[model samples]
Target: MAHKVFISYKKEDLQFKNQLVSLFNQNKVDVIDKSLNDIIPSDNLDYVMQVLRRDYLSDSTVTIFLIGEHSSEREGNDFQGRPHQAFIKKELQATLFDRENNSRSGLLGVVLPNMYDKVYQGTSICSTCGGTHNIVAIDDSTVIKEFSANYYIKPHNKCAYTEDDRYAVLVKWDEFYSSPEVFIDQAFDKRKEPVANRVTVYPK
Candidate 1:
């Protein structure tokens, strides 16, 4: 049977998500489209969770967070200085604790193109981090920025929630485009295994 995969992504990458959906359909991948972008925004988080559990993530076997630029940005959770109200948190929690068959859906992440880097006060954007900064870049000549934007910040802040979520720290993400199917398969297979929070693209 085909797995019903719920695709999660930032609204900024709508085009990429559509193209990815097309490819999945072309390949006849057994993933059902259960994305929640059809209607107006929910009134509150409770309403949102109600709708998701009752409909959006219904019967989903896996969730593929289509990582993109600003995917991990916590703007949604920043409602009037409220952090716990983050929509992504609700989504992730729903995937693991939705009112379903009491089984957590497998978690898989596709580190899509345009996955961005985060900038903090003591750090500067890497020169090779492509053009444009997603967030405000600071002038920090005193403190040395540990992570240079290469493939280092590729996954964004995936492990922000759990110390160990998925994805081995050493996996070559550059190969994802060439072997997407293989990557998905591997990720799905190991979804249940324990994983460590990846600090760098090239694990130290």
Candidate 2:
């Protein structure tokens, strides 16, 4: 059977969404476009997750998280003079387990090449909106392992949520941008393959 993919990303990544829709159109892949509503408050974490599983994620078997610069960002806690929210966590946590209505879906992360910014020697900042990216990428295996572990571990601080590696298939910005079908296929078919060896490309 063909893969049923659900794309995930911050709403600001419109161009990335367009690219995905366009690619799927040309290649005849299936994309389910159900995103979280904006009006929902971060304080309603329970409702947010409930709606996510029941409404947005119940139909798909894989989630394609377009890992942009700010994909790891989170809402400030309520005590910080704001409502507590963990939308990033909600999207990611969806990948680890099955919704009551759907089977557990795998995750695929396609990094945005444009989100990479060059700051200094051997160091390029990969973040959204000109901010610094604080996530670590020690090596392919380390990166993959860290991601695998973090998906199951939830921290107290919402602002510190940068564990996008739940995506077993991690695609480089250009590699995915140029030829998405190849990697999308990899995500769907090679379920147990060692994604640890997949090339880790950082954009500048």
Candidate 3:
């Protein structure tokens, strides 16, 4: 089956969302961003929360939260003081709905590439609980592994999550294609691959 990915973003991030949607579509991943307009209504915060807690959370195989300046300022949050709330909060809550929801599927974060200044300057608060901001990376296997072990191990919890190796393989494709030589040189141990005795990409 084709991979299912849900994209959560703010209205102000329409352009970025569209770009991601198109990229994933081109790469053959089924995107849930199609409900962009229908999912987030201007006047109905309840509707948005309901859909996330129920519909989107139930069906999506994975979630991709696109972080921007205003993503967490939505109304569902109690307005503690932060600039943005985290989508993971909803994901964890909804993922625990059923006792048997053991599938710890993919969870990814995409930060605005150029918005590091605001993030680093600590100018904004988390729109949800008014906590400090944290940026999680897609390639962090350690975090993913620990989270998976916690959720998927004995006495399984509701917020169980995992990063499939196949997903990592797909992610690595970008690195491989960008600089095949660099990837081969760095990833493979010289002793294990025995490059001196084998064919090398570099000039002999």
- Model 2 superposed RMSD (Cα): 10.3
Residue-by-residue lDDT tens digits, candidate 1, 33-138: 5444342276576677667755766666666665544554333345466542245445555555523354455555555544323222233344664433333231
lDDT of 3 by residue, 1-204 (tens): 455666656677778778766776666657676443465654444456456646665565555555555543233444754223333333433322232343333434345655444333433455655665434332222222222222233332323223221121112223333433332222222212222122211111
lDDT of 2 at 169: 63
Q: What is the lDDT of residue 68 in candidate 1?
A: 47
Instruction: Count clashing residue pairs in model 1.
Output: 0
TM-score of each: 0.56, 0.60, 0.44
- Candidate 2: clashing residue pairs, number: 2
Query: Higher TM-score: candidate 1 or 3?
Result: 1
Steric clashes per prediction: 0, 2, 8
Task: Say which candidate scores most in lDDT.
Answer: 2
- Better candidate number, 2 or 3, judged by lDDT: 2
Ranking by TM-score: 2, 1, 3
lDDT of 1 at 26: 76
Candidate 2 residues lying further than 4 Å off, grouped into runs, are: 38-43, 73-85, 99-101, 115-167, 190-204
Candidate order by decreasing lDDT: 2, 1, 3
